[model samples]
Target: MKPEKLSDIKKELAGRTVQELTEICLRIAKYKKENKELLNYLLFDSDDPLLFSEKVKTFLEEDFKAMQKHYYHSTKSLRKILRIMNRYAKYTGNKQVEVEFSLWFCTNFLHYADLNTSHKPLQAIFIRQLEKISRLLPKLHEDLQFDYQGEFETLLHKADSQARWVSKSLYL
Candidate 1:
């Protein structure tokens, strides 16, 4: 079935009473885990995005420590962690948070894993995330962009040295 447009949904929601909206939100939250998570973030965690991101960083640190040494297994877990980070970024709708998560992910990826593998898929993940951050940097405010650019450049240099496949010039 086709879903209603966002405008139509907004209009209908605007007509809802406070109790009705709460009931609707509860029903939606019960239908999906992601819906529940988004609601939780909006209601509670939305006030302090920096704090939320720090909690995520701590969670990711544990996840990274748990990652398997095998390339195939590590790749699967890494992508799963990436999905979680993406979800948090989507919930916040904040560019700085996304960049923060991306940088943290890349830094831990390089530090925790030995990217010295002869193949390229994991290196590809690292490179893709860096590219994603580079694309986002321009959209941020000048001070934030400058602050993050230094970190990004540092990641670039580290990535270039770690994985044989990544070329520093491509991202620069």
Candidate 2:
């Protein structure tokens, strides 16, 4: 699959309303699920490893495209949130928490994506880094609402620890 043109997606999203963008996000999620299913089939069911590898590579490319589309749609909501925060900050005279939240949100989202897409061996490393960042997020400010923080931290630590054990077990 050809790489998605970021500029084209940005242009398309720029003209769409919030409702339309949400609809597009749903469609993109559906497409991503379909792509993942196809990849799983190619990876696990094919007799020819070479052919399967090629198909998997193609599937990954398509998956990335879908991810780009979803990210583009999400950017619309993120921008709106940032705009509202900016306005609120201006009136309230407190921009630090809002800015920190925006930074944490963006970084966490990208790290989550990277962790999901990384190879099994490297996934643990990313997850560990994400966990560290997640911990720092709460320290950034007290005003930030980190809903499900406990659940996420637990999951991240579990994933990283399991992956590390697996890697070490293989080595031993």
Candidate 3:
């Protein structure tokens, strides 16, 4: 079945009392993980997006630390971690959080999963995510875009400079 449009949903919800809305939201959250995560963010984490992003980063770091070091396993594990991070980013639907999460992913990928460059598929995955982060940057407010642009530029430069080094070290 087709879902109702967001505007229609908003109009209907506008007439709801606080308790009614809470009950409806709780019922929705009962059946879907994404719904629950979104509700949790709106209720508790929305007040401090930076903290939420940092918490996600910590989770990413832990996942990275637990990853198998073999190149084949590393690529698969990185993809899984990135998928989880993207889900958290979607729960917020916040551009700043997206950029921050992407930056954190890139940093962790480069530092802990340097072997990404050793395999063409892994390198392509890294580049694709960089492209996605670039796309997201333009969607932020002008001030935030400018600030994040600087960070992306630095990341791009590092990725480019490290490519050759990563290739050379492939046999080590």
All-Cα superposition RMSD per candidate: 1.1, 18.9, 4.7
Task: Give the distance in Å from residue 118's predicted Cα in candidate 1 to where it truly belongs.
Answer: 2.3
Highest TM-score against the true fold, candidate: 1
Cα lDDT tens digits for candidate 3, 1-172 = 9999999999999999999998998999999988898898889999898899998888778889988877788889988998889999887778899889888888778778764346876786777778788788889999998888888777777776766533322211
TM of each candidate vs. truth: 0.95, 0.23, 0.82
Which pairs clash in the backbone of model 1? none
Q: Which stretches of candidate 1 lie over 4 Å from their true place?
A: none
Worst 10 residues of 1 by lDDT: 112-121
TM-score-better candidate, 1 vs 3: 1
- Expressed as tens digits, the lDDT of each residue in 21-122 for candidate 2 is 878766665777654444444456444443433443344333333443243443444344434433433332333333333334434434334333334433
Colliding residue pairs in candidate 3: none
Using alpha carbons, what is the TM-score of model 1?
Answer: 0.95
Task: Please report, in order, the local distance difference test score of every candidate based on alpha carbons.
Answer: 0.90, 0.44, 0.81
